[model samples]
Target: MSRIAVIGAGIAGLTVAAELAAAGHAVTVFEKSRGPGGRCATRRSAAGPFDHGAPGFEAVTAAFAEQVQDWQRAGWVGADAAAGASRLIGVPSMNALAQQLASHLPPGASLRVETHVAAIEHGAPAGWRLRLLDGQLNAGHFDAVAVAVPAEQAAALLAPDASLAEAMRVTRSDPCWTVMAAWSDAWAAPGGSWTAPDPTGVLDRVHRDDARTGRVALDGIASRWVLHATPQWSADHLGAAPAEVIAALTAVLAKSLGVHLAPPVHAAAHCWRYAQVPDARGEPCGWNASLQLGACGDAWHGAGDVAGSRPDGVERAWLSARALARQMALSLTPD
Candidate 1:
């Protein structure tokens, strides 16, 4: 069995790690965050936890569809009764899916959270070396390394290898500003809305977390809303103060609801520098067989809707990770 390293504990990395482990490879997954869940992200607070990133996603491909069915059976995810019977979300919280996937790894496969792989380098014997954010080299070598970080971040790592660089040459992702609003009582709009499209042009979509199938308030929080600003707005207000972003978006939200909305007891704003790739492209995953280096994530492939449009955030990550894992597993053998 080969020793593999999969970076980023997001859905894509976790998925690839799980697949490689199932293939009998010894895999170690690295994550920078305190736990797994990268934009399947949740922000924990005294009032409650909010899925500040992608609220949920669709299972378009059959492979992904079957996996979703398995996740459903395992209770890692469930159908979003409000969005439709098809839209799927992680149970309990958006990060729960990552947690479950991380736990499903085989005996030799493992996940290391709070560890950041700052850079990747070539090394003999181990084949690859990981330089961590702490400026320390990882303990050993990895026969193969799969990167599943944001495309923007992956560019730096892939730059050392020309073929890998060319594979993701045209990939781009936009920034986003998301706001979370929590209240002790349900959001009091004219008629309660599970979701609302932006009327003020300052936002993209607004959703109520309480309306989703399996969300219960924590502490004093009984109601929650997630507001996502348009890319243009987010870019325009980039690096703006959180309190300012909160005020501006909430005012727009009040206008959309046509109410003199009382302030949320708990509210905050978060900025995602690389949020979505509306036009993600390239091969299913970037691979350099000669280097045994590869990359995958939402920025890779998988766009097979009737209109040829890609599935939203989470599914794209899953698609690319699964494809890359298959490629790596089949080709990997003991030297």
Candidate 2:
């Protein structure tokens, strides 16, 4: 077994680490945040918790579907009937899914949260070296490295490697501005979830998290909603202050509801810089044999979709990580 380093503790990184560790390889994951879940993010507050990133994702392939079934059995995830019978979300919070996946990693595998890998320094006498954000720390001499971060981030980390660099160039991602709003006891929510298809649009969709998961609750509160701005709108106001974005999106939400809504009891705005990749191309994952460097994420491969219907996010990450692990296995041999 060989020692390997996987960067970013998102679904992709966690999948790669778990699969490699299961194969008897010693693996370690480095994550920038305090916990797992890159875009599968959640924010907790005195008001409650909010899944401001991805609401949920579809399981396309049988491999991913089986994983979801396992999670369901373990109570890590559940079907959101309000969103759709097929739609699945992490219980308690969206990050719970990543946390569960991280927990299932093999005994030899370890996760380092709140650890940022600032740069990758290759060409070491032993193997690749990781330059962490903390100047005093160092990690290196791995058989291989898997960078399972966003395409843009992967590109930056693998810039010294030509093949991986070219592979990430084709993928293009967009921004998203989201608002989490909760109603006061005085204002009753209309109920249910909605997806707006208005041609003259400022918003993309709005979902009732309370209906979907019932994970968030505040005293005297009836319902909560996460409003997502359209890609175009998000791009136009990408740099706008949070208050400005919230105000404009609230107006859009009012227009969608066709009702004069009262002020929210609680409201917050979050910006996702690399939210979605509308157009992306390349292999399911990329690896450089010479440098033993690789990358995998939902942004890799073709339009990360299932039968050209559902946009593959969580499932795609799983598939890409599996592919990378297999490649790593083939390249590394036991001592």
User: Which is the leading candidate under lDDT?
Assistant: 1
lDDT of every model, 2 decimals: 0.82, 0.81
Question: Which RMSD does model 1 reach against the true structure?
Answer: 2.2
Off by over 4 Å in 1: 185-187, 190-199, 218-222, 303-309
Clashes by residue pair, model 1: none
- Candidate 2 residues 98-177, lDDT tens each? 99988888888999988888888777578877888876446456778899988877888888797787667657788999
> Per-residue lDDT for 36-155 in model 1, tens only?
989898888766778889888887777788889999999989988777788788898889999888887777789988898988889776588899998999987888899999888888
RMSD of 2: 2.1
Report the lDDT of model 1 for residue 314. Answer: 86
Pairs of colliding residues, candidate 2: none
The weakest ten consecutive residues by lDDT in model 1 span 190-199
